[model samples]
Target: MGSAVSSAAFSTRPGLLDGLDPEQLAAASAPRGPVCVLAGAGTGKTRTITHRIAHLIQSGHVAAGQVLAVTFTARAAGEMRARLRGLGVDGAQALTFHAAARRQLRYFWPRVVGDRLWDLLEGKLRLVAQAANRAGVATEAEVLRDLASEIEWAKATLVSPDDYPAVAARTQRDTPAPAAQVAEVYRNYEKIKNSAQVLDFDDLLLHTTAVLEEHGDVATEFRDRYRCFVVDEYQDVTPLQQRLLNAWLGGRDDLTVVGDANQTIYSFGGASPRPLLEFTRRFPEATVVRLERDYRSTPQVVSLANKVIGAARGRPAGSRLQLIGQRPDGPEPRFAEYDDEPAEAVAVAGRIRQLLDAGVPASQIAVLYRVNAQSEAYEQALSELDIPYLVRGGERFFARKEVRQAISALRVATSRPSGADVVEQVRTALAGVGLTEQPPPGGAAKERWDALLSLVELAEELAATVQDADLARYVAELEQRAAAQHPPTVEGVTLASLHAAKGLEWDAVFLVGLAEGTVPIQHADGDDSAIEEERRLFYVGVTRAREHLSLTWALSRNAGGRRHRRRSRFLYGLIPEDHPAARVARAQGKTFGGATARCRVCGGGLTATLEVKLGRCARCPSNVDEELLERLKSWRSDRSRELKVPPFVVFTDATLVAIAEQRPADDGALVSISGIGATKLERFGAEVLAVVRAAGRG
Candidate 1:
């Protein structure tokens, strides 16, 4: 029995380097000091990092608590910690860059500044708007939001207000506002934040770096505490983060960085792959290892991803790491074309239903697109089909407007320096916000209320664990928890943007809206570097599949009433002329030229006049009452005129057809149709249904 027990236990515990390829093993076992791992997509980068940490600990080179592992997202950090636990290691400092800085600030704040840390300013845009107003700059919400983004970009790149115009001219980057105007707003915004005595998220890293640089003892303490560092997605490191990392290292070269230059897609957010590209120059003796073996995607998908990456220019010459797929051969990726966006969404939804029917778990599939706005049609289609799906990278729970408002109120009530009981302070904050009453009836409002209530419950639980139960301490913990929170892992299909889908994989993946303007993204029109990053974004999407993959695009968009679109240029180069997928896409495009232009509403054949310009077919016999249909058209036309956009932008003719056919009486029923989502439903549901009721009476 003892021998059998020992065998089972040993079987459960995998060896540190059991399944790693030779290159990965080399990376994991390399001597310490400035190691760089150029890991391609689907390569076992995470595995290599985890194994390396375990090896270091098991070999008695470093204690678990002394190693700091940083990743780009909370999900990645949690996965690293879990993997370490499985490897019989714990208490390691696995966190995001912001989380690590926040911890350091909390630890050294008293020693450096001799006071409690100020609250983090969550209303950054609001403050920017106020500053813009005071500075006599345009205070339009859109302008403020753009300027706020510019401010963030400036800080991340360590550009000061005085240097804004010179930097903008040097880079030849376009700004939504004039460079001088943006500079004015940035200066005023800083003055306002300083007057308010609050630090924004960026200020956490800035302040921590300041503390470390100005105080030798604190810097020494941190360096002694964390002797080794491992940074994941090192290509996306911004200058500010690099400076902070350097401060923590105290000029030591004990760092392991893993990234792929081909996957650096966040240049717009002030990230650069230059650090990863120049690692060898910075540390001449650095050991460099490349992991080319892809363990996530099948051979076909891997081939396509490599082809996409090959088209990218401006990469370090001869430094591109091509991925070799290890997963078994699977179906060649499907390329589907549709007449319009709505129809494309319908077809994709049908395929998802089929996959689920074939016993594939809903959680094993994802539908990825270029922008968040592209998710509406897919969300509507999935909801109509009753397939459970989760939309990632939307307003996160903590970042929602309603949640922010509640948190702001809580901050006000707890901002006092007096030592108040945590539970009482939280109760007072909830009561102050008028959340003491029952939650309101609307779905969104109810969710907001539940989030606040959950915070209250958390405070009570926290109070039991600490002495004195200070509200400030509770708030600090709350902020830390929010930073590390991941989207709840409900069983559902994931709908995410390509940027959000990095480091994630699905058994079956759908890449949608691969049109020229959408994939290269309209902003990237004439810029070579931006286009290359777009191609890298496409590569990221392609490599997310393990078995099945589909690349889809529409011939025209429904929003602007049938503006024609071409296939993405990246696809044109990546899919060779003789390739079967290319041929399939071309063949699919041919179906639209015949006399078979179908009704966007019901998919019925349209007569010649109706077929022209995609008009509705009278002979098809509308399921919608004729009067109701006319009224919806009138409402859409008026809204289009009010918004100064095309009529279809308000509600496409196809969506009207769906609404008429369904005759939804309420918001719940109205949102069930394709093309109608929360925003549209909230904007037009009452009026649309009022028209339906009048028609019913008529």
Candidate 2:
């Protein structure tokens, strides 16, 4: 340590490793030579990686500029850079794979081929459509999109156009087009891209790997420049990415990778955990470290995550790292079942409202779903409740159909020689799409208009920032920004897809749509690997919770006036009927009658006559006063109409029932209800008590 410290700049920092636990400290200080850290969620993976970088530089084992740290997103790269700066380290290169490859390609393009590199193609679907036309592959737009995605997957897996059909056939993976037709489309796509002198995102890695492999001198230059390499989220690395890393290293062993195989949720994008799983075999001298202590979630949450991952199949032996909770004991993760999607959404919104009243910040709570489509119900429910929320990782603003239409019109309108002002062009585009300053009628339509307006504002701001900014340059910049756009931060509840929730944590998480076809995903029906990836995705969702966690699923989904669904198999053993963590809530449908009565709090059914007379299941507390509850509901309805808001916004039915049972006589007592915050108490507290008093007298 003494010899290593003399040449480094951070020798004076005394408490660099004080906060890290023993395992994390060992990982941070491990000797550098093909090191692999299997870091589970909330196990201080970022801290360990950043501290390891600092340790290497402070010990003088690697120069700051000579280290290359690769992350999966621009935000992650920024976070790592900030951490390194805090540790008194500078000049280290932290970049995403695409960013790093794009840089190298730009720097070495002239040296390698002596020709100008084309701009990356922004409209992949357009190119795919053109290819479809050339190949005479007449199909619906959905089929065309599926083909485009398959082409991307093939490219990432390094399958040639000629080999795509064979590979797909051998693997029996589902495809929208026939194998021959898909291959034809792929070949035509290549021709179209070559003719236009453009490259898509995947080509960035493909072309760089080609250049480095074809030119040993160029590879040697990179190898000399970057002496140490560290990769984050290594479990999601594509084969092509692995090859690029190997080419850059050129047989050197100065490599460290950190990831959790159980959190590998991107197999649909052709990412595989094999590179991480087989790190020891790839680098025979590798030092492997496992970080198991989870500092983010409570013991209950950690245990539930462990149980979910333990049931997953096809994981490598000894690869299942159980998380030892580092936080105090808390409530067990809850499971709620609903009759349908809309009912499930309402129940979840009510629960979120309760949590908010209990003083949990909205930002600390998240609603996670298996797919983007599941968000619509929750969005409607939250909107009805007047709850603020921000949807992440769903459709991008620029990708919306209306926005795209507007942009298309703008491109044409601005292409003229007269060259109208940016604002005028935006106006023209909106006019063409039948949009004006006034918002649309429906909530969804209004949202689309707002998104387009934001785009217009963004254009105006960009133009103002740059004097004489033309429409063409402005459009190019917009495309670039769209490609790199991360989810925006807003003060509201988060609604995100499971994929988007990775590497993020919350104090409470609601995992919705855990039904059979949704969680396992219909696409993974016959594929073992695909199913395993779905399980991993569930694991990722479970581990995102720091304290409170809830899993919800609907018994049916309505389509064309028919209901269909089945419970997700993964939840069978996890939330059995007798499980202490499980709860059932009645959906907005027919109630149980005859021989049994269902608990309104926990979905459990009560069969005995005494239990039925008590009007509560064995699991939850006794029922509220029915007549008083009806009076409260009537009052809420009248108040909602008076305020021109939804009934739930005034106060949820659950909150009203709680108030009736408590019989709060004043504002202070009213505020004690689960959903009655200070705002509600001040606004309608007196009226609520008057209703209660009148009901009591009656």
Candidate 3:
């Protein structure tokens, strides 16, 4: 509280952090009631906050465990922790709101929740889902699953069943069910959870807030423990999260929140940026930082994103998040419309194969869509083409019973140090699944659950040796990787709903299912804001493409000849003046695809192929040798099989074909090929050239 403590405790010299500008540093270092960083994608807002945390800790202002950094996702939290460690502040508690809530609930479950909570909650949900299905409220299991999600969201937003009709009538009234029914269902769910003496995910935060509110001393303890806080993706913080944040701060804490108002796409989940945007007004001492330099995308992609955003007038203006396109330039955003879903899928698959033949890798390509429903076509095509893909934001890892049980066991083992919870939960969930027929001999369950228990034990040992601040992060990261076959798709070729895909970027993005009832979203047209949001959604989708961008729309979908729908308004907006799509809808284009070449003599297709990304039509004089193409394709196929990614993904059909046709004799020749930019050349240039040379020899 004294001048010496204030000056000595927290200070940062300019240039200590990489990626952040001096302005960002000043804003981040400022101790204040509130600070807002309005940054575009990849301008290093993340880097700024990270260094800020490091500065706070190193200056002796905020103790290691006293600083809390909250992110929108568990993965993002892990990333921030890792980055902070890189900056020499390894112990800051970087966490997602839900994760923090979970910790709080677990630490005080006995006092706040009593002992009978867990079993009661689970049984209640099970019974409700069963009854709902039998009562014809929801006929199918999938419908029940959706209902369960709705139930959770409603509760998390603190919406009571009595409040459902009013809330539902006010927001998204067009949804199928009446507000009263929704309210009834919610009422039932609460009853069930209470009867079972258990809490669902929502209850974690709600109960934590309740505990803090009721126990002033405990709230004060936490506030004193973490004097400084940083939250990333602040635009998406829900009301529940805001409550938690308020509770943690105890009305006064140094806070830094960074987000883009344009990226406020998670409103369905109760996420909003009003809190972030209003920070300065709400807290008189708040400082605002705006970042416009886009280090993640190309000028072309950024310009398009800007234009799309411009089309939506209401959003708060900030620095333009431009794209500093990293990969070698290949193609601009493409626009295409197909006859139907299957044909569109086929075309996309063939394009990948062609790109593979040229030289682009499967790992560098992604097929993104507006909804999960659209993935079916791409999934089928990729499966047929033998493409290996990881879907992003598809399912929550904790939602998987197996993964949850495993993680819970791991947490228990880590918490107890001696591995008690691992023994308890595994036995409990296993018994529910009928995995354990009879009670295990004393300690037998713990011994049998070796895989998870061992990890818990390792975490326990890690905690003792590692600093407490670092122990949580260490455990979180290990659990993240160990909890699944794949880390929930933070990277790779991301297949995501446009909504979920809002904040991320990729090397090449293929936007599929750009048809009506999908992009504008069937219900989004009535409200002007909704329409603008749709446009913003399209903009979000297009901006995700760092280099190559493609949009595809199918006229129809035929599942056993039950023909489906029309082109999406989004695609309709892409047609050129002379194109038919323009007449029907306002389509414009500097379209990527024009015409497919066919041989004049044999009428055989003259498919243009790529060697990585250098494209050449079959008729191009610079084509690689036929035998070389065969060999390169064969080798690539083998690698693709091993990796499980589609062959096109392994290498674009175009890239493969270019290697064969343009037999790059050396590095110079290789660089001459398209898409063979500096990074690719440095990473795989020698091997790629060797493959070309060897193929030519064979």
Candidate 4:
């Protein structure tokens, strides 16, 4: 293990160190030379990495400043840093690859591009995009974004443009981009970046590696300064990131990396674990550690997660991922099916309410979905129920108008000696918030800028007014932190689409919109690797459940009552046939009533249904025509959309069917139906009453 032992063996610390697991201890003790830690979900992969960093620092094996820890996301880096600080070691560098690349770029920009190059070249790429669009090239912003992402993926994987076709062909298995075009753009983009001395997100790493590899003194200085490197999510490293890591090592080859190949889900984004997998091959002297015991899930849930991954391709079998249950006999992962989506939403809201009543905190629950569009139903349901929930990603905070305006003000006021990272932050925030449309004038916009900059001015004045240096310091630190992570205004529950939910966890997770196309995802089925990635997504959703996991899907979406959705295929073979949901499916049969089923009033059978109910049969006549039936239902549902509307106000299928069947000619008769309460009768009583009377008269 190279003499870096567990905290328990050291007998130096008290709280956190005393409770270290053996796997964690082993991870801490292993001497670094391209180390790879393959662990299952909740097996304390994060714990092992954090402790190892702590051990390195506490043992004086590396200076805090010499240690560089790279994570896949800014949030993950922040979390790792917080954990390290809690262990009383604070000097180590913790940042995302992007952040690290930006830092290094700033350090070497003067030499790379001479003086004053960054400012003039700012947003030139946007101009390029505009020109490309104007020139009648493929220019839809969305298409450009996709192409830009394609370029980034190639760069990140360290795949030169020439290699893009073969690699993309193999990895994508379908929809491969033309190799020649990729090469041309790759060449053009590089030329532009070099000439302008500016870098896009990927160029940060690409150029930094170039500068370091070309300059021995610069490389050596960085390598010697950072003797220890700790990497989290090692499975996600692209070739470019690996090259950057090699440059950081500067041939020293001393480092600690923690990752799990099974949890590798970013392959589509051009991230690969081959570098970590081939770590020993490259160094010929490296250690590998496996952490399989999960510390977060129950035996049953862990078993489910393990079984799903076990069925996946390319993953090793023996080291199956397992979960360690924290509570005694938590609820089993339940599956439910509904005739339509609104019912599913109501059911999910009902489940959350039940959990809350049983003692789960609102913050403890998270509702995850395959995409942001799927969140609409859950948000609607939650709003109706008055439940508090936060979406994980998307432009919630960054998209707010007030917040954007406020940040523009702050950026201008705090624009003192701002480094590249700070400048990028301000630029991104300003541009994202739509302030760029009427941006403050460079020199002429000073007064207008200060006018909008009142928030920052007030905060500074407040800091000056406070007598407690500690309080003032705290305020200043908070201002800096806010300036870094949050924009001016922050409100509403997080609304993260699934792509944005990576590297994050919540207490109670509701994975809504778990339908076939959305989950395996419509686009994922074309490739085997992509399918495996989808399985990993399910794994991510499952592992995210610290206590409760609820999975749901809708039979229909849209206001027109279009019903053409199927349950997620990923859940097909894994969940047992005897499960409650399977039995429900068996009962419903393969084909069921969908949206636009013929009105019982008109006596037409648009779609056939098995005899599962009493009121409507294949032979019955609908009270009103199809359009009238649909209109009545639409009116009823619209009322349901209003906050605080009682359940009965929204006519249940049974009640609607009864009204259609009986053709009630008056309010007295309509009020007699099930679920038609006094409140509903008073508010919508006349509407229903008139519909019935009109139907009878016609």
Candidate 5:
């Protein structure tokens, strides 16, 4: 672990090294040799590397055209080019690995293979679907995503289809399908691509490497053309990527790699931190510099980030770069707990409202969660609060293809009365589109499944609260939702997953849904390595907060549901075990809820959606069915529309919620409810009683 380096350590210099700290200046102007930069999160890695490129150009060490810099994403590549241009240096090749490789392959294919280069595949889902069919596999749209990921992994790891099964089995890879079936799919995918004369993203790198490796003259020309190389996010280098990097170097050592081993959370995508960790071993005389001073987050946030990553197991000794915050201290991170998922979302949105009210620009704040599926509740909650929010790098809730299809199916279902439970009816409709209880293997398919399953949860909530909930009304709500999440003229708070939130920062970050199964995730249960990666991902989330940070989770998924969820184990050492936010000490089974939840009406355990939302239960002397209240509200809304009156004219929302909690079985008890008088009861008594009876509440 590196110690804190104060500003006293930085030495002033002229030209490109003007504002660079001592470590950065050393790394930037290091002798012409292999350079390794262990750039911790929030450290000025981009600044150091980009300045180094400019330094090399102005100092006559390397020509601008010969400098090839590659990063993982196009946005980062574009930023690199823009920064280089800002420094008054032009003609440098700053591009994504695929972009750089595609250009090289396109230029060399005719010379090397004596034929035209095939069309490059921007996405492999279409081809994977075809391959799935050829393999006698009936793949859904989501399964195609899983297959594509598996195929990409195999190709990146340089494992042939014949070797994929053994490699996958050896690594205990959680393949989308059986090892043999996936291998067959991969084999057929290659065959189909070959017959169609096309190359994918991975094939570009592979082909470029092959051209250089086979043709000595071409390799010499390429190496001479591009004399200096700088690779960002070196910890994410897959085996195939590293091989191509080596071919680009052509046995020379004019290479610089910037990465942090602790931030290596993309292992599932075949990325290995080995290249970054063993950089010195590859080039014995490499100049290694560790940039531990973080300039983004405050000391309080930095300390939390350090603790999170430090708690991970199997991290290489001395390889974990301990971050030292360079910024002034702000407020300490806040930890919050809620009763359920919806409660969590509402609370987060309310906190954001407070921040916005206090004059923090919405664009400066963010709400990040473990997965994209968790985005829907936040979207709905924000919309309810009239708080603008944009789902960054994810599909908006109602805009998803599955959601649109499910809504269309539900619309068709309203043609006749099914008389079935709304939740069950939703299940039937979703199943018509191949969405069932069990989700497919991880990746796009699993994410799609999660997105669709969230709809079922909404239906369950609808049925729990609304006695007269039907397919038509549910479809109406979804349509309203589709229209509600519109783009605002003003910049909105960002909602993104942890993976997407990487490389970004926010002033106030609300990290929600940190429950046991969500942050560590259920799939990482048995694997220590997977769990460690989760820890790293959590660390990433923690570091994204520049000042105000709130880490929150819920006791249950829904109101009144069993509060059995344990806080994420990653927080065990970070937060106090006996704190109110952490309700239990899992190892000791000790309880820590500040206030025990008890039903007000019957003093019984409150553990279901309606029960918690109502704060009461059935079997009380005066009762109103929570389910019946929802039914009354739905009926009241439709009735009010017919009568050309407001919904409150039929029955207030509070009255309906109270009715559900009271579980009133008779007209006498119904009239006793605050919102129901003798006159009002006379008008709607028969219809309300019929709904309650249908709900088995009367």
Candidate 6:
């Protein structure tokens, strides 16, 4: 009550405890000492944590500048900052562990290290390659990549090269090479990186930890600067990250963390739910709150999600969240058994079509699968039906460098106090930074340009679609995106891997390719822990649906093929035998493990149809911008027809690609394209620029 934020300003913000459920209110109000909020899927974890920070600042317990909130992703951090601003609090630092560490490293490296810090490598591959060569380990590009991941895992788990061989063997890690060879490569990598004075992302935390552990003054300053700390996704903290966090905290205990142990799906990436599960052990007096209400999904969807996770074996005792659905009742989840993969994809797409026709926005529908390979069939089926869709890859969206840089610029501009509208402010901030009208044909430079252009379009959209929108409002929208992992509503259905579907929700969700080997995944076959993770993944997918939820599995890989596949084991005890799902599987054929397949119902011997993802999946760009670039291309396509010339004649693919990537909106911009001279600009500049302008206006 004694904080700088006056009662008048705080009253208008209903999000601070006023709107919180009882459990959230308890977690948010207990803004002192150690607090752990066990947030379930679909629960308002972001809301609760943001409100807790707001309450701490607004109620005078902590100043906004003294509080630090950390999440796992840039977008999530952005989301927290936006929400705090909405609650009339500002100046708090909400960032990913890497972002926070990098900020500190940038500031203190000179003072602590007595010189500038080493260049942080954007990627580890080039360095890993050199290390492989130095260590006499011959590797192709793919093998190099796998080794890079192995190195990352070792670093994340705080394992040294000396530790990796034993650790990998102990954990049964599927090493790309023999454990000893991989460890040798890892050692060479460290030696090379040190010699070159370069550090990879994981090293960012390692170096920071070393600095703090080795330097007293820097650690003191960091701890003083951030008195109160909040960490989101506590379940997914790698051991290296926890070390960095501990270094930041020094000996302080003013911390709050939110996570669900049951949602621990990133063990392969060195994330464990142990920190969340054992929070009370470290701080015996810690206030632990469990958020069970499922606010994002219908009761039907929530019940199914709860059921799915309920069957998971070997889960830590009391770790699972028994979700209590809070939304109005919706239809029971639908289950289907297809004769083949093609039939399943077609059936899923057909139902999606019906849902789209009935008025569910394409953006509110998603087809979630276990692995990227399963997407091909759905992609073909959706394309055949003339449905627009996005196939999501692995990389986190807001973690892109261009996006982070653009946001940093926006923040700087916001601090200066701009006179222009939100969109204009963004454009001015990004003017020469990357949002040029013309751009390169390919590579990172073009990707950077496209990211900035998308931000501009996002600003334009907010300015037009929102009432009296400003930079603050635009930031808030980004916050919403960060909180949900939902990008701006693209005008297409989303096809994402289940891991990609975490922290996101939809009105209609179709979970496809739920056969045994695909769902539990072949790698999980021998490991109980890995199998449990797969079950958690299934729970994540189930909870994403708000209304219509259809789950399908193929009995075979091809039409009229041997019915050797079986439904996911996770689905077995969840869906009843009398259900159409089980009936259909029974009618086709039921097969579990081994080459010899037997029908579950009739005891008939059947041939096998292998379900594979890792071996069969195709690879593609892991990061794609869903921005005005796509819209500009679509508009350019229309112009191609109206000009009464072939599309290429109107503008070569290179020029058009440039136009789309740059989102050029003026004559100067158009003429700068590779093939677009003054003549072409005179002919089609208005048309091309108009698309960018329209995209800006939403």
Report RMSD (Å) for each prediction in the order shown: 9.5, 12.0, 13.1, 10.5, 14.9, 13.1
| Residue-wise C-alpha lDDT for candidate 5, range 551-609, written one tens digit per residue | 99998997547889978988887875665773322333211134444567667664433
lDDT tens digits, residues 360-446, model 6?
988799999988878877766665455667667644457766666777777777677867788888888887477776755432355
Taken over the whole model, the C-alpha lDDT of each candidate is: 0.78, 0.78, 0.62, 0.62, 0.78, 0.76
TM-scores for all candidates? 0.76, 0.72, 0.68, 0.71, 0.71, 0.74
Cα error, residue 284 of model 1, in Å, equals 1.6
lDDT of 1 by residue, 576-691 (tens): 46655432222222233244545656666543322322334455555666677888898889887885555655676767766767688888888755446665676678889888
lDDT per residue, candidate 2, 1-698, as tens digits?
Answer: 00111112224246877787867777787776888888988999999999999998888899999999998987687667657866778789888898889989999999997988779997688889999988888757897889889999999999999998899999886877888889999999999998999999999999999999999899888888899999999999999899989888888899999998888888878998888888888876676778899999999999989999999887785368989999999998898766667667867887898898899987789999988888877876675454667788544655667767876776786667556777667666677686676875433445566666666776676566556767776676555555555322334688999998888889999999999999989878888888988899999999999999999888767421244677798887788567543333323322332233455467666533223323445567755778888988888888788856567667765567667666888888777544455556656788888988898899
How well does candidate 6 score on lDDT at residue 222?
Answer: 80
Q: Which pairs of residues have clashing backbones in candidate 6?
A: 79-479
Clashing pairs in 2: 584-602, 584-603
Say which candidate scores most in TM-score. Answer: 1
Model 6 stretches astray by more than 4 angstroms: 1-15, 394-487, 582-698
The Cα error of candidate 3 at residue 135, in Å, is: 8.4
Runs in model 3 lying further than 4 Å from the true structure: 1-11, 113-127, 130-139, 317-330, 354-361, 393-477, 483-493, 558-698
The residue-level lDDT of candidate 5 at 135 comes to: 89
In candidate 5, stretches whose alpha carbon ends up further than 4 angstroms from where it belongs are: 1-13, 114-116, 395-490, 582-698
Lowest-lDDT window of 10 residues in candidate 2? 1-10
Model 3 / residue 91 / CA error / Å: 1.3
